[model samples]
Every structure is written in structure tokens, then in C-alpha cells.
Target chain A: MTSAFALSDHDSAQLPLATELIAVIVASSGGAARILTIGGGDRLPSGPLESRHRSLQSGLRAWVEAQTRHQLGYMEQLYTFADPDRTGSAPNVRVISVSYLGLTRESQKASFSDAGWRDWYRYFPWEDHRAGAPPLIAAAIAPRLSAWAHGATTAALRRERRQRADITFGLNGHRWNEELALHRYELMFEAGLVEEAHRAGADLRERAGLFGRPMVHDHRRILATGIARLRAKIKYRPVVFELMPDEFTLFQLQQTVESLSGRLLHKQNFRRFIEQQQLVEETGDIATETGGRPAKLFRFRREVRIERAIGGTKLPTPRS
Target chain B: MTSAFALSDHDSAQLPLATELIAVIVASSGGAARILTIGGGDRLPSGPLESRHRSLQSGLRAWVEAQTRHQLGYMEQLYTFADPDRTGSAPNVRVISVSYLGLTRESQKASFSDAGWRDWYRYFPWEDHRAGAPPLIAAAIAPRLSAWAHGATTAALRRERRQRADITFGLNGHRWNEELALHRYELMFEAGLVEEAHRAGADLRERAGLFGRPMVHDHRRILATGIARLRAKIKYRPVVFELMPDEFTLFQLQQTVESLSGRLLHKQNFRRFIEQQQLVEETGDIATETGGRPAKLFRFRREVRIERAIGGTKLPTPRS
Candidate 1:
């Protein structure tokens, strides 16, 4: 390491301070990224930290099932912090958020009436470009955003605003990255396209499809944060394993990626990436035909896992 | 997103009639992951989620800071509702944990005598293999673990335990993944190398090493969750930007990754990763050199943030 802690003029100082946690729960089905929803709000299942708990996961598990009534199969910690001077709820109180990204096989449907679940894409309609991106990118968002860009008082500000929109929404022919989920949300929020911004007025809120479903408070922002993290994560680590069944077909796997990304991939390149990576193993089982001849079934190879670090699996996801 | 929500023929619904949350905090200098402590306990900052608050993160922020004066920065949601059964804590009372991951710059040193922060590696010394992994791995761990594997009563149980240990600790010649922060902790807990479970018997606890520091409740475990998440995250996204000042040199950027990951990356590879990914832009500035060449100071390329999603970046680390 460039500078080990032992040699960094460091101290074993402890801060008996407050911290916060959050959760990002995602499951996939029907070629779409689905987040477990509660009470019609697209919030990931979350709660508060307590002294009585034995561990963080234990606390997270309790929170998830209490609302959803289903045990979480795969769970991992996301991020942590104490936001300085965050006002609105408790007076003069400090808040911390510890977030988690959860993945599970969707076996339970919404049972009770009050409790509800929805497709993540429904909230972020523009994310779905599986059918080659919607016309809104060129026709609607660009024109309105162009006006917004010109509205900037200074040239530097205008250029910055234009660049932000272009990179985030992939205007000017940049490849759309499925991973910029959080950036995309923030960009829309900045442009007053989302409902959260009271500044948007009713017209933009109703017409701006670029803005996703409005969330309670920052829940949507938090969801976007999780999506951004997950989008970047699946490329290097075997985290996709958490979202998959023990045994599944490549098509199902690819569909899950597309769903979370809200964009389509070059099929041939994707297959080549999977095959070359040796990420999966032939299970000696075959699935009934979906299109062409019956395809072979495969399971994640447990050994290739230890052979490399975060990446070695050449995922040939073409930008074209 | 095949079939948004899959309904199983068998209906088994689990409901969380109650809620809870936890916070995982980290402050790093050089490259060491910092752990939060309470009453001298190596634990995560935490509290219960109650109706007294308006939003989840807000509630968490309030509780944590109420105890510690330190304000947090760069917080993200970790995980949600972890425990399914209310059996771990109080009976018949449902709970949910909206865990969060937090980062602090640590501008001020810890003043509280009873509360403190410590290097995360001190607890998991073997994790920091920067100058080649600590000898404890093969010398102390492998042999004892083999006996534990053999200690299982049934043959199948023995195999299961052995497989788990191997995968977790990378025993019998397995490559270690620093990102498996939680897995390493869970493995230590299982192996009885951690102080939490072994302290009941003095010898076991002592042998665990500066091994695992005891956390108040499950806070340390929550910290582990945060460490693992951050380690994995730094690879793709520019989250390190959150922790950095407005402008910094490539060396400073590299040191941060080394500290958090506790593993070194090839320097050339790291620089190449930063350049090709276009994560940073030159600010027309240069920093005075301490030794070799004065490194060019660069600002995070806020515009190119979306580009990272299309491709992953490498860190300037010396590969182990």
C-alpha cells in the first residue's frame, strides 16, 4: 500500500458519534429491474438502528420481512454517514444512514391490500431503451433542455449545464450507460423536471417523462444512488450471483442486466463476454425452447470466483 | 424484469409489523479503514427507528449524533430489514433496520476518553496484506481451521464447514478478495477467531489477536458491512470524490484507495484506469513535489461521471 495506516502519522482516535444507514432492495423478473415496494411508495425497505440488535444484517432482515413478509435471501451493506445540519425532522439532532442492496428470487406477490409492489422501470420510464431509446431523448428532452441551457446567465454556466444533460442523458450521441442511474435522477431534479422540485410547476411535472415517479422525500434519490452503485458493481464482482437463481439460463441472466440498466445490449457481444469469462458452468441440463432450438442451462461456477479480483470476467457489453 | 413480481403457487407471506435501523461509519487516513466505537466498544453507530421521526435517514441522523457530537459526511443507505424473526431481540415486537454507510473526514481528533476509533485492520490484521499478507494467515489460521473442519460431527457437516472456510478465508490456496469484508467477518465469527463470541473463554479471545475487537452489540459487524461495500464500490464509481477535497494529485487519490481497500494496485494500472476512464480533469494546476515529479492536480470530471457506467476503471495500485 502507498501509505499504510501504521505509517500515516495516524492515531487510534475514536469518535463516539452518530451514524446513518439505508437500504436498496432489487429483484428482477420479466426483463425489468423491480424494487420491492411498500404502501404504493417506491421506497426500498428501511428502518432505524437500535442498541438491541446483535448485528446490522439481523436488523435489516427484520425490517425487510416486517413490511414484505418474505425472508431476504441475499443482502449486502451499501454505504454509511452522518449528514451535517440536515433539518426537517428531529430538532438539532444528527442523522446517519447505513444503506444495503438486497437481491432475492421473486416468489411472493403482493398479498394484503395496503402492501404493494411495483416494477422499478415503471417509476423510471425513460430508463427502458430495450427497444432502442424512446424518441423523447431527441424530440422532447433535448429541446426543453436546450432552452434550459440557454437560460443560463453565463457562457460557462450554460456550457456546464449542457454538458451535464448530454453526459447524463446521452445527448450528442454518447453511449448511454445503465449505471448512471443516480446521475440521471439528479440531472432531472436539477432541471426541474421531477415532481419533487416544487419549482417545476404542474405542467413540467406532468409532461416531463424524463423525471421518474416522485418518491416520498429523498427516497427516489436514495433509490437512484443504489441503482448507480449496483449498475457499476455488476461489471466487476460476482454480485449478479445474488440476484440469480442457483440455476438459470443465460437469456434470463442477460434480461436481468437489461432491466436494471434500462438499456439493451448487443446480444452477440454479451454472449461472447459470458462464454469467454467462464463465469458459468454447463449444468448438463437443457431448457425448453424459447426461440430457436432448446438451449443449455448453466449455473454459476463457484471456483472461477477465487481466480481473479474484482474483474477478469471480460463482459463484452458493447456501447453501440 | 420477467414477470414483475412472481407469485408462487404456495403462498407464504411474512409481515414485519414493526421496524428498526443501523449505521456503519468509517473515517480513513492514508489507507486504513476507520471503525466507530462507543463506550470503547468496536461497534457501528446505531439507534431504533420510531414514529417520533418524519423520515428514515433523518431519524438515524438524530439518534447517532445525539450520542456523539461528530457530524458525518457522505452517507448512503446500507441494507434494510435483516432479521425475519423477532426472536433475537424483544419478543412479539417487530423491528426493521435501515442500515447506512457513512464517511467522515475526521477534522477533529477524538476527545472522549472512553470512546474511540481504531484501524479496522487492527481487528482484521490478516486483511492488510499490503507488504505481503501478515504471516498469521498460514501460520495461525490454516492449521486451526483444518481442525475446525475436522471437528464437525457428521461427514457432510464437515464438508460443508470446510467448504465455507475455504471460500471465506481462501484456505487451501485461494485468492483473497478484499471486497469480501462481511464474508471475512462472518467467517471469523464462525471460526471463533473474533472476540465477540470467544471472550467468554479468555484463551480463545486472546488468541483471536488484536484479532477482532469487541463491538457494543453488532456494531462492528455493521462496520464490516460498510468496509466491504466501500471496497467494492471504489472500483467503478467515483465515490472517492465524496471523500476528497475539491482538487488533489494522482498520489493523494491513490493513497485513499489503498487505505480503504487495504490492498495495493499496480501504479501504472491505477494511473491508466484514472486517465482512460476520464474520471478527473486537469485544473491547470500542479502540486509541489516531495520527491520525484510534481504531480498534476486534477478535479473530478463531474461531466464525465456518466461515462464510468459504460466502462469500469482501474486504481493506481501495486498489485500484490
Candidate 2:
């Protein structure tokens, strides 16, 4: 039995533990969902939690703002990742990364030369179903995943693996669930179909590109977590407003949601659902920039945030 | 601007930052939701993340099972609290507490002499609405909260305070939201209505008793977080089955959900909603233990966990 305080001279107390705050700042623009990234779109803007920072959230905001020069809005803690092998840090030095998801309006070029907003789908192309599930899934992912599933030791294990693949990737008659972004990434990683898996010694470098572009360290995984969180959250919370401009046409609003969710929404159903919730109100103005007939502009009702705690706004995605 | 690597001599790296894992293991029995507690029901079972522990969750489970001699089921990370002043540790030390919410069947007597299960409502009397709003809110809490709201310096500040209070506590025609358990607790703490607030130097020792029993340190706050998470989760996720026995009647299931949610559910609507989800199956047995009539026993369909990631089970609580 191990004692609770069994400090073996190399425990966390003796070893230096660095707390890192990573930000996943998201925005929607030009019919695409984007994320602010540093290091030439390879890593998220992150910094060590310093002594001067009053709280974890403040530390994250400071780090992101300093690096990107883009003010974050509607931030929430996503998750804390502290697996010892996750960062591949020195054995004695542990890194605990607390990640946060921040939403904002359209992106501007960051102050730092390398810091810029990149289309989120660029990293996970298969995730986007706005134009139907990208061809990469059928062309590359399914065959590799099927082989991986059949490679399992026992028939029961093979069945379990195949089922998991079907559920995560929407294969074998399963519906593509936008909320399973993280699960899909994880499954691909397990199947050695992604670059991270190859980097982790899976010996499948050739199969990486079709899956998605990989980021430095675990930034891609963190992004997947952020994507999944936002995808799930927008179905219930009014957080999508944080990423919207002051006013937008119904088409623009629907486009933004579809971009983030990686799936096309039924236009009439989406507008009806939004109207039924009373989450938005007509601005009594029309937008001529929508390219065809002038459409009435709408702004989110900020008062709904106070009136209802949950403020649920169900997305009307057509049943697949 | 402070550099990202601005680490002072007394920063987290040099200072011994103790990583603590706290568990809010919950169950429902005898028409009440109960939580497992140690130190005579004043403290949750917690232990430091030790060197032998492979992961944060494993460390939590190991500590809890060792301390209480009870197995945990269906565990999920609740939140990680890491405010430097949260634990009031020494100037050189910091504490990072990662809390988890676990659900299991009704509690048995724990091996530890002081460990036992206590009704969750004992610590949050105002939270329960199963018998409608408790009288303590009107008799004691309202006046004190009103005074706190009015005590703010400026008129605008006072109005803001009052509005926040009303929104959080469901005052002035606002519908009572069971998921705001943490918000309510925090509001009371800020208003100096809870004993822990008094401990933090708010001179309100006399009014503490009416609020609810207070736990040591920030355990009560953590418990509130757990309660809030569970209440919110049960609406979207079929997690209530984790707290049920192998076989149970629909009435028992509703009671268990009500106990955890602190609100009564509409019987017919709740049963209908459950049936629509198809999350449970009849056990082909009748339970005569249900007082008047023989009730059919049902068990949760565990396979739904694999098929649907977020198998939603909406509790049909009549609108207030």
C-alpha cells in the first residue's frame, strides 16, 4: 500500500512543476471558423502562470492578449491536461497545462509576426460536413481505420474497435455527430492514422496528411477539445453571440454557426429555432451587403443572458 | 510588461505546490441525496497527488477507496480550483485542488470510524424544492440578503447587487433554477450569509445556522460545484443510473433524480420522457417492496452509453 504522502525525494514537491496557461481563442469570419495561433500556426498562445497573476483565468487572458494582441471575450476553462507523458517534458519537471476557450469577433492580424488566425478546419478537414463530410474520410480514413479495427487481437476486440470507429467517424451507417470532434481525433490517433500517432512512434507517416495537419506538442488535441466544447456548448448556451458582430443577417448568423459546428444547418429551421428562442431581435435595419435582396439585420438580445440562466438555443440541424 | 518566464524566487516552481484531489461521491437513499464524508461529515475524502499515483483520477480514486472502503463508479472531472488564496496556505506554498464528481449506489457503512454518508440537503437546506421552497428562505435569508444588497455604497451598485441577488436566489418572480446551486452558494458567501464567509472575517456568526451546516475549508463550495454539475448534467446526460441499484421502479428512479436535483418531477411526464429515450429496460420482475402495488423493476440499458455519446434524459420538472 502506498502512503498518501510517500514522497520519494523525486515527488512533485521536490521536482519543479510548471503551470502553463494555454488559450484557444476562436472567431468566425469569411464563412470559416478560425483559431488564433502562435509559432506560424503551430501552437496556441501560452505562457507560464506567474506569481503576479491573481488567478488562473487572469493569467490566461494576460498571456493570450500579450501574445496575440486580440482581446478575448467570453472565456471559459476548457480542461486541465496534466498527463506526465503528454508534454514529454523532463522526467523531473512536470508541466500542468490549463487550457481555456475564448470567443471573439472576426480576427485581425496579430501584432506578433507569426501569430495569426487560421481556419480551424485546416487542421481537421474531415470534421467539416458543411459541404458534406470531406472526401478525405472515404478516400483515406475509412480503409485505414477498418484495417486497424481488424488488426485487434480477438474477434470481440475487433468488433469493439470497429464499433468505436463507426460511432466516432460516422461510418457503417452511423450519423456524423459534430460534437465528437475530439473523439474522432483520438480514435484516428489510436489507429495511427494521424501524424501525432506517427510522431509517438506508430510508424505510419504516409497516412498522416489525409487525416489533418498536426500542430506542435498537443496543440492539435487541445484545439480538438476546444472545438468539441464549442460544438456542444452552442447547442445550449448563447455563447455564439460572443463570436458575432454587432449586427448580422440571418444567413450570416447561420453561416457562422455552420462554420463552427462543421455541419450545414437547415436555413428555415435554423431561423425559426432562433426566432422561437427570442435570443435575437430585429435591428429595424436592412443589410445591402448580403449580395442579393436586402435582408433585415438582427442583434442578439443581451437581456436574455440575465433573464434565463441556461438560455438554451437549440440548433436545428437536419437529421442525418 | 512581465515576461512569460518571469518566475520569482517564490514562484510555483520553487515553492512546493501541493496537488490535492477532492472527491464528491454522491448517492441517493431514503428520499434524500447523500454524500460520502470523512472527519464526522465535515470534510470530503481528499489526499495529495502522490508519486505512486499514475494520474490525477487514479490518485483520487485510490485515496477515496482507501479512506472510505467504498468503490466509486461513473466518475468525471468536475473542476480544478487553483486560486492561491483559496486554501489560505503559507506565503511560500500553493495548493491546486482538482475535484471530481462520482456517482454510485446507496452507501454502506464505511470502514473508517468517522466516515459516513450524510444528507446533502443538511448542508444546503435552501437548495431543496421537492417540498416546494423551504420556509427558511423567507423567514431568514430574504431580509439578510436584502440588507446586503442595500448595503452597497452607490445607488447603481446597490441596484446591481440586488438584481444579482434576485437572479441567483430566484427572488422577485424569477423562476427557481435548481442548476444554480453553486451560484446560490457563492452569492450567500459573498453576502456573508454562510459560515465560511464569517470565517473569512465577515462578522455573521449568528446568522450561519439558518443558512446550512458548513464544512471545513472550501469543501462546501466544492460540494456546491458538484451539486450544480450533477443537476445540470442529468438534464443532458443519462447519469442518474449510476446512483441506482441493479433493479428499481420508475417511482424510485424519479425520487433519486428529485433528491439529486432538489426538485420534484412530474411523474407521468418524467416516465414518458424516460421511455422516449429508451435508456432503460424492464427486468422481468415485480417489486412488492413498493408499498401498495407490485411495481415492475427496470435496469438501465448500459449499451446506450456506447451508441449515443450524450444520451440526453430530460427531467420533466413542471415550470415554476
Candidate 3:
């Protein structure tokens, strides 16, 4: 056990460290997934972890509510970002940003002047595949990625780069994996295609808006992490209920999941799986809002939270 | 868009903060799961994050290797502990411990004098259920937990506490959830049944030995967190291979998984599931060590790491 308690003078005289709390509050509505953003939709709600804060999570919730005027619920720590190269802070100071993902409904509009919910697809134009893979993936992303792969110094390096690009972006017979949201964004960042790459001294001014709208600092990267986590989490956990209404038709539930995952599901298969899992129960009410036949409303069974804690809920997502 | 950059003089005059990197290195051998411990099995190998460390992960690997001389192969960030109450640091200094879970084989012996691998069940006796639920649950834990529940002030509070105890410890027909290791430890802590609770002003000096041996400064809690994470991860990820030898029989693989999960797996069903997943391939060798019959050896298919990255590997453990 090396003692962290006894620090030498040199080790003790470390750089001034600051902790930042950032939130990626997500909501789904009208067949689209949205994230809460501020500063004219350029930054996530964030604040410094002050001395008065008791814990990391409480501080995050406080900061997010204060900045957006919307109380966060169903939040979990996403990741802690501490790499000095990613922060772009002052030279003498080190910044640690702890980001969180919060799931909520879009009913309560944020009261802050600049805080608003923006469609998540607007930031990642190539992610949405509900209607089919977005054209931007083929028209813009693939060509640049190929060029980046071929530009490697050696053939081995070029092959490795090409394989990585193919695996990440699901190109040339590779299946498109919706959960690789972070991987795709990271590959683009490495290929110097995103605006953040340009900000970090990459020569990509010509392809500024081709990738996606970049957030301040590494907030976009954090958002990508949140998206990837949520996409993967939904398959094993009953967390999608966090973004759902109290009582909703099965169609609305499927649509919300599809919107968040950026992929469509077979309607019959989705309904059958949900029924088999017994994750939801009939509300004894009907939703007549559908222009077609009225659909039965259902509520997420709360008991599953306790019962399925060990045997986790499994969503049957068809392979692409 | 609340700025984490600007800091007031008062906020800047905050307590001196130190970041500690802790590794919960895990391995399975001889039908038992073990963890690498230092300081006579009372402390996990940990060190303060130094300025020269490139990233949080790098700092962790360097610190663990320096302390134990064991090279880490596969690792992931478990959780970052920043709650002030959890760390018993100096009055004016805040210690933030970022813990990681590392999976490795038990082939290399740690070179340090105090460093040794201890069976995980020694610290979490009630967690093991290979043969049956450990007697410690009914004999020691349940009665104390029930008393704690009834000790609550109001009827509603008491009912809630009882329900919580029942759910957490699997009392009165509730199923034992192997992944709730941390929750069980925390409940015991709250009930003042553990030695650490006594150290923190709880009157549990008499019942100290009843619960498992306590580690120094929340290390045991961190270990429980690691156990819970690994148990859950192994169900959905092919990470057990990180703790296995190059070649082994199917029975060995099942034993390794059962040891880590603290539960028994059906032999035929486990083999069938593994074969269906295509996670392993025949190495064209035979293990003659087993006296009864020579069994075929197999190696984990490396390609599954990429192919199953999106659709994770699932283990079919029988319901308790």
C-alpha cells in the first residue's frame, strides 16, 4: 500500500486543479431525441464544483438546474475527462470535467433565456438511420475517411487506419452499429474532419460543417459518450422508461427507442419482445390520438426494477 | 453556459485536492476468485496521481505495477469516488479516488513482500453461493439486518427499511442478486455490522468479527464495487478470457465464471450457450490433467472482440 497521504514537497506542489460538472440532459418527443443545450445551443449546462457542494452528483444536479431551470432526473455519471490535451485550459492549471447523462421528458420547457432542447440528430447528421443511413455518411464522410486512411505513411499503417475506419463507420460490407456513436465521432476527430480537430490545429477549415456542429471544448465528445452509453444501456436495462411518459401506447414507446438509438425496429418484433419481457402492463386505457385504430396504453411495471435487477431486461434489436 | 473557467478568490481558496488512483486487480484460480492486496491484505495498491502521469489510466497502471510489480492486461474505469464523507483524509485536503477494475491471470507472482492474492470470499463471505447461500446470511447478517429495519422510527420508514433489507439480501423468498455485492456491503455498513462502521463511531465493536474483515479506508467498499461491476460485466462481455490461461477445458471456463460470479452454472447449458455464442474455438489440444477423461482445450476467439463489440456477449446463468 503506497500511501497517498504523505506527499513530498515537489509532489504536493502540483498544479491548481479544478473540477467541472457537465450535464447531457436528454429527452424524446415527436419521434425525435433531443438534448438540453445552452449558450445559443453551443454548450452543455456546466459549472465548477464549488466547496459548498457535498458530492459530485448533487453538485451536478444543482448546477444543471440552476443553469437550465429544469430539474434533472434519472441521472448517472457518464465519464470523467482529465486528459490535459482534451481540456484546452490554462497551462498552469489542470481541469477535470465529470460529465453526467440525465433522462427526462420534454414537457417542461427550460426557463433559462438561452437554454433549449435541440434535436440530437442536428449535431450528428450521419447518425440517424430511422429512414435509412443518412446520405452525408456516403457523400461526405466516406471519401474523407478513405483519403485519411490512404495518407498514412506506410502500407501497414494505411491498412490499420482503413480497417479502423471501416470498423468504426461500418463501411464496405461492415454492419452499421448504432452503439458505436463515440467511436465514429472519435475516428472523425482523428481524421481531422470535425471542427474540434480543426480547433486542435488540424487543417480542416474547408470541411467545417460537414461532420457535425461542434460544442464548446470537448462537450460534443462528452455528448457522444452519453449517446453511446445510452444506446448500449437501453439494450440491457429498463432505462428507456426514464424518457417515456407515465402512460403511452406501445407505438410511442417504440418510436422513442428508435429515435434515441438512431435506428428503426421491426414493429411486430419490437411489440412481441416488449410483451414477452413483461416490462410494461396495460393501463386499462386507450390512446385515441392515433389517426388509425385506437391503441392500448401501457405503463412500465415498477416491480421489474427490483425483480430484474439480476436478470437484466434484454431488448431484442435486430442485426443491421 | 455557466463558465467553469472563471473562479472567484473565495472559490479559488478551496481545500487542497489530491487525486488517488486505486486498482482492484482480480483473478480466478482453483475454483476461487481472488484480489491482489497489499499491507497484509488490508489495503489495495494505490498512489496519488502525479503530474508526470499522462492520463488517469496510465497513472493507475504505473502505480499498480510500481507497488505490486504485476503487469495489468485488460482494465476499465469502474467508478470515481469523490464524496468527501467516503475519504478519511486530512481536515483541509480532499482526496478523490478514481478506482479501476483490472482482469489478469494469476500466473505472475507479485514481487513485493506484503503484496499477495487473497480469496475474494474471505472478505465477502456472504457473497458466495456456489453450493448454497452461505450460512453467514441466515446466521449473522439477516437477524442484525432485521433489527436495523425494525429500529427505524416510523412505521413507513420501518417498512421501507425492511423491504430494502429483504431486496438487498434476498430475504423471505427474494432472489439473491449476485451483482448487488456493493449494496449488501453498504447495507451492512449502514446497519453498523462491519468494523469500518465501528471505526466511524458506530457501536459494533462486539460484532466486528461477524462480518468479513474490513480493509483500510474504504478499500473493502471499493472491492465490493469491483466485484459487482465484474459480475455484471461478465454476463454481457467476454472479459473472463482475460483471467484464463492460453488453453483450457470447457469445465475450467465454467469454473472460472462461477468463481467470479459466486454462483453455480449448469454445465450442459453453459457449454451449449458458449458454443452458440461462438466465443471460443478448439485449440486442437487435450487437457490430460483431469483424471477421469481427457478433455479438449480451447482458446478465446480474438475476432469476437470486434464482431461482438456492438451486440455484447450474453451468459445464460440459471435463475436462482
Best by DockQ: 3
All candidates: CA RMSD in angstroms? Answer: 8.7, 2.9, 2.9
lDDT of 2: 0.81
Error of 3 at A26 (Å): 0.8
Poorest stretch of ten by lDDT in candidate 2 chain A: A4-13
Cα misplacement distance, residue B197 of candidate 1 (Å): 1.8
Q: Over the stretch A190-282, how does candidate 1's per-residue lDDT look in tens digits? A: 777677765324454545335557765566777777778777667766667777877788888888887777666788788778887888998
Where does model 3 exceed 4 Å of error?
A: A1-9, A153-160, A276-285, A301-311, A318-320, B8-15, B302-304, B308-311
Clashing pairs in 2: none
Q: Model 3: per-residue lDDT, tens digit, A1-320?
A: 34434444565537567777889999999899999998878889888777677778888888877778888778998888678676666865667778899998876755587889999888898899988888988988999999999999999778877877787778998878888899898988888888887785655465555678888998898999999999988987888888998999999999999999989888898999899889899999999989999999999997675555445666776534
**Model 2 docking tier (incorrect/acceptable/medium/high):** acceptable
Clashing pairs for predicted structure model 3, backbone only: none
lDDT of 1 at A282: 89
The residue-level lDDT of candidate 1 at A289 comes to 67
Number of the top lDDT candidate: 3
User: DockQ for the candidate 2 complex?
Assistant: 0.40
